[model samples]
Target: MDLEPPLSYGHGICRPRGFAKDPLVKTVPAIEALHPEMTEWRRDFHRHPELSFEETRTAGLVAQRLRDFGLDPVEGIGKTGVAAVIDSGKPGPSLALRADMDALPMDDRGGKDWHSHTAGVAHTCGHDGHTAALLGVARHLAAHPPASGRVVLIFQPAEENGLGARAMIDDGLLDRFPFDEVYAFHNMPLLAPGQAGVRTGPTLNGYIVWEIAVEGVGGHGAAFFKATDPLQAAARLAAEISSIVGRYLDPAESGLITVCSLQAGHSHNVIPAHATLSGTMRALKPEVMELLYQRLETACRGVAELTGCTIACKRLAEVPPCVNAPEGADRAAAACAEVLGEGAVIRDHPPFPFTDDFALFLEAAPGAYLFLGQESAMCHNPAYDFDDALLPVAASIFTTLVRQRLGYAGTHARSVAPPST
Candidate 1:
């Protein structure tokens, strides 16, 4: 295949002394060479999306591919999640490179032949791309070993519901496969494809998903003052809950409480005994999340007393804030610059309001999360699909971080023939 001189602006590939120094250093070509095959895998995954911990088929395929690349993948680590390590057979700090594997419980109506066949399930968050990029790294790294170190590729499950990363952690992710640092990325909407972005601290918000149930006396709707209306209590509770973020929390601080759903009586003429209110609370810090929780319970109690109804709240899932290490964040931002040009990357970017399950990994070790740009409909939108061309862009970022950490020097990196297609 015809190739160009690997960019030397900052050092691309360092030639190992054992093999003849061939001039292919940049990751763009090394990963781009396998881009076609990677696209095939991405599209196939897009066509069949799975949700949360039920990613059996997707996880199986991931393990099979890793095996094909000569990495002995361990499957079902965190209930349908997969992980494996690639050792350089030398001493160096170990780092975990993670990619979430699971799709949202939604459907994409986008006009494409490869749209998901599963009803009410699709990869609107671009996980299909995330998974494919890591696999590309596995293939690239296998052919191109680092100077020395172990890089663990973790394909985690159930990120959508905010339990995947933590589940993996509780399943002994840190204890079994030790690492000094962790890294992962998400695709951003409304930016130029391959444009990279990172934030040093408070990279993402912490969030809590909870549901509150109200119980009261049921009676005929015509019995005006005889029945304790749970539906009324639920309505009042929802309004009071909405005011928590605005009234109790500082306006300068970021906090959001969204009421996603409310369920009450099925019949219009009868007062139901029970009503439910569910939504999410998000903030920039964990303490803020705790305060919100306290206020919510207080509001529920007040509403319960006002309507003479009993209320109980349960937290479904909680995702901690994603805060990155200062040095690790700088290195990741530099790696983005390496792949997407200095002008194309943005450090100290505004924090993402959304929550990430990957934050659990940061709790175990120092690491960073980044946004890879792709111009399209916003994520979680039914029409969104991951941009395939960015696979090489992501692959380059992953490898650059590994090489930067391990200290690039002359080392033997196996060679793999580029795809003919």
Candidate 2:
């Protein structure tokens, strides 16, 4: 159940050997037609944001919607994730599209009309928008099945904590609903609202969090020289580790280290015997992460020697980088180009510093993870909210990606089947 992902998922995605040129934008207009309903769904989710592994009502709503669209939705994958299949009753290839469904543990300060109804739970990451957009795709796909193939729509949970993707994989997500390729996307801040970025290489970095525990003899502060002060060691380590991101890595390469939390003495008069320092290290390449761990252990050893403290470093939640396969990347770029124009897709963008659980999905199956540009407040910020105007855009992107991946060409391109919302 805890198997690590393959070292690299470099195979071509499921398509016509190569990516289709300029994915047909036939469904773009139809997706635009469903904008109002999609916005309603997104706002409803925004008002009732749920935290990781607890998306009961959100999952229920998605399930009902999928059912209404005439697809059999299976609940309870990866705790609160949902997966539904559109078999098309024919055979070609299976493609999977995923969107996360969870909110961060924070108060809503965006002041939107449909801000979080629950205090300390907010959808600052734009997952509400992602869910709604996927729902739009679900309705569209249900009404107009591809000529031949299966399309699996996955509504995942716990993305903020970086475990949901793995949980779903372990729960036989791949075995139960196997696909030739997989895809997912996240909204980005500060970019044009109608554009997206997709590349064929590492799109996001890998990260590992380390918690360092140091223990030394506690003694009276009046005679501090007599005792090994763990607090002093912790202070020194925290400052030095902060420089690791910029100092340790090459000037041209990308890496980050954040000494976020430190805990030590409780009383002013006494030097505490125990202290802990915790933070994270991120890098775009696997080798960089390896080198980072080595440097971290070296830092711990050097600090311990200087402070005469016993130090123990524990690595937590080491997530791998999310790289997009060539086929999937091309398909995604073409889809974006078809929907929003060629200028809307960035094929050679740099990797993001943050980590995504979707990395695990790409590792399991050759796929791509894209970023949709929408001018808005940065994610994870208290005031951040997904731009409602981007709903139809993302939905169009999803629709085009699916059609291109399945090679839905010719007459099927122009028709809009009976509406399903």
Candidate 3:
């Protein structure tokens, strides 16, 4: 939902938070200069949290900051997304770096100084830190322009609901700001702060949100024999759906099916005519996900026949698994190794069950999605906050990627060309 800021809420730049350096990670020397400001911007974003496609304030701030950094930012893309380009005068393969810009629809009980001011909204997934880090990248790249190729900065909205990346792509994002390679990262609480996780293939699972409906006769609770209880049918279907992962999936493969919600009659004395069941199914492989969906439908049919009820299943949303291209993954690992050392670059982590719409972008271009470690509460947890320490580390890695791909170097900086409108 769209929640506007108060009139007193100004878009002026936030004061630097003076974030301390992390001893374990060797961040880029150049990014260290912007650490405090990046933390401040991140906290500012956390304080004024916005949800899903309703990131007007966040987008406005991003566009304004990009302009301040001397880059022209296009607004209203994907409804509330923002993008800016830093063109290097010389001709070379262009690179795009992206960050999501939406907050979760939950309470901010973290009790931090910069806790979310809006009710029922919070930056629980570290998107605030991602946005702030990308902004820092923009500021750094604007000043230090790439050695040859251009860099496109994307501030995408609605990633939480798995729509932002597709939204931008459907709005001709790729055509408008074309790039040969793309890259994005999400903060992970599973590893130590500043450590990087990069897997060669299937970094994230594909998922489908599904709903099931069961129809039967309704009657008073007292009339037990006469009533055809849809709730019982729905309950059986839920149990059957839960078993699909274990019963149908291959032993070597991993998948998940969860029944998150079930709704039936409102009154305790009555049996409802209809019942609804909804949940999600996730798998690392597209074929596996398809198999799971097939099994789910089969289970529904069998449950319907056994209970003498009409059952129908509907798919709400689907996202393909995020597989990192070999070239992109290698570059990401090298970049991480350059910034955080080789030992900190993890390559053995299994595919995450979580889904990101960034999968759509990976499908469009050769790129990778890496996870930067943070020593904090798990993502989506109310207590989670993006480690300010990661600001410099993440920005450093993005900068190093440009240097590695586009031939940019800190020693010989080029004069930045004027940003185009």
Each prediction's TM-score versus the true structure: 0.89, 0.88, 0.89
**Ranking of all candidate structures by their TM-score, best first:** 3, 1, 2
**Residue-wise C-alpha lDDT for candidate 1, range 1-421, written one tens digit per residue:** 0012122121222223211112222345667678889899999999989999999999999999999999999998988889999888899989889998899887787668899999999988889999999999999787677778889999999988888888888889888899998999998764445456777888788899999999999999999489999999999998899889879998788777888899999987899999999999888789899999999999988998788999999899998899988887888988887666576677756677778889889888898998876766778877787887678778878988887788554444423333333
- Backbone clashes in model 2, listed as residue pairs: none
Worst 10 residues of 2 by lDDT: 12-21
Q: Write the per-residue lDDT of candidate 2 for residues 1-421, one digit (tens) a residue.
A: 0112223222222222111122422236777789889999999999999999999999999999999998899999998999998876777888899999999999999998998999999999999999999999999888887767888899999988888888899899999999888899898763455557788988888888889999999999999989999999999888777767667788877677778899999998999999999988877788888888888888899999888899999997878888899988998888777765676677766666678888888887888998876666788888998887677778777787777767553465655333332
Instruction: Kindly provide the TM-score of model 1 when superposed on the true structure, using C-alpha atoms.
Output: 0.89
lDDT (0-100) at residue 210 of candidate 2? 89
Q: Compared with the true structure, what per-residue lDDT tens digits does model 3 show for residues 1-421?
A: 1112112211212212222243435566778779889999999999999999999999999999999999999999999999999998889988999999999989988889999999999999999999999999999889888779799899999998888888898999999999889999998766556567888989888889999989999999999579788999999888888888778888999788889999999999999999999998887889999999999899889988887889999998888899999999999999998776677787767666688888888898899999887777778888888888888888988988988899874565433222223
TM-score: which candidate is best? 3
lDDT of 2 at 397: 77
Local lDDT at 85 for model 3: 93
After superposition, candidate 3 runs with Cα above 4 Å error: 1-24, 222-228, 409-421
| Per-candidate clashes, comma-separated | 0, 0, 0
> Which ten residues in a row are the worst by lDDT in model 1?
1-10
Off by over 4 Å in 1: 1-27, 408-421
